[model samples]
Target: MPVKIRAATQHMAMFSVDADAAQAMIDYSGLRVCRYRPNRAVAVLMLMRYIDGDLGEYLEYGTNIMVNPPGSNESGMRALQSAGAFIHHLPVDQAFTLEAGRSIWGYPKVMADFTVTDGHHFGFDVTIDGQFAVGIDFRPGLPVPSRFTSKPQVHPTYSHLDGVTRETAGEMTLSGVRYRLGGATVRLGQHAYAAELASLGFPKRAMISSSADNVEMTFGDAKEIA
Candidate 1:
């Protein structure tokens, strides 16, 4: 259906999780957590502000689990290298985008409110279902080489909702990108979903955090994962 994001300011962070607890959080059929070790898994969090896009202006927050690609035996570094993600929770502020995300890609998108502070250092405060969820802040670390910046990379993502699982190869290109080791700070609040995220060892520093000022993305058809 042709989804494109023309300009955005986004922040992302990665965290390590106990694989068993992570797996219990997902509990989706046909999906396996990619263990970084015997019991460690990777969890990812992102906050994005889409200034221009086919879906219109909206804010989004996501928590995803690193997973083995469907039907693959890859594990550890191999699976990490595979770069496959399974969406656990996605919240957006726009109704149209919310419906579009779910109807088109089976994304489990829920309506939420966001308070954003934009700049070199970015902040996002998200409230879900009328309760405060999380407050996330990011600080830049070092410059990513120009060669690596503004390049398109297609990311494989899986989503299971309403008894349907779908895979999408979402591509993004970015500029003004900066990242740092342990660059993220998070605060948990009254929402139950916030507690759900806390299960993965939150209220702690992120292993890595990054921010980009201008970004572009594209999403095409979603393939059913058998």
Candidate 2:
């Protein structure tokens, strides 16, 4: 109850990775990777700056792969629509959020430094212990399909770490959402889990989108993933 559910600005670049590679990553955690096709998986790289929240203000860089638990239907539509994202790497600039997120949702959050700027584009760089981990430069101002926000994008995520697995449902609403097939630069470093990006052929320039305004969001308490 200490964490505040508030507004935040989010920037993201989505990529299609080799389904086998992504499935390997998910397999390590005992989860199943959700595939858009038989051989491709969706990966989302995000940079978020909270304008106002229970933890005040902070920036976070997240690398997530869409996935579902073993029993979940693996059919593209059912799998992709579950909102069962698996967090592979997460770094936050604030300790308050780091602890709160991990305690509440089993989010794999670690303390780090983040630099963000925007003008003609949305940009961010995340550093942990003076080493670059990930960065993104994205262009906004694109057309969004009416169906993109036609319904609430609410879904549950399952996080498994340190021998524990937790599930939390989050309903996210992004204002001024814009969609585009390309127009973003992504960078992944060699340190830590950042190196894993290479296996997915990350920064390959795929689907990109952005929201100039705030992200309306809420997270439910964690429950053991079934």
Candidate 2, residues 39-61: lDDT per residue as tens digits? 88889888888887777688888
Per lDDT, the best of the predicted structures is 1
What's the residue-level lDDT of 173 in candidate 2?
A: 72
lDDT, model 1, position 194: 82
Candidate lDDT (C-alpha), each: 0.86, 0.76
TM-score of 2: 0.90
For candidate 2, give the lDDT of residue 212. Answer: 39
Tens-place lDDT per residue, model 1, 3-91, is 88888877899988888888888877468899978898999999888999999998999989999888776677766988588998899
Off-target runs (Cα >4 Å) in candidate 2 are 1-4, 143-151
In model 2, what lDDT does residue 57 have? Answer: 85
Clashing pairs for predicted structure model 1, backbone only: none
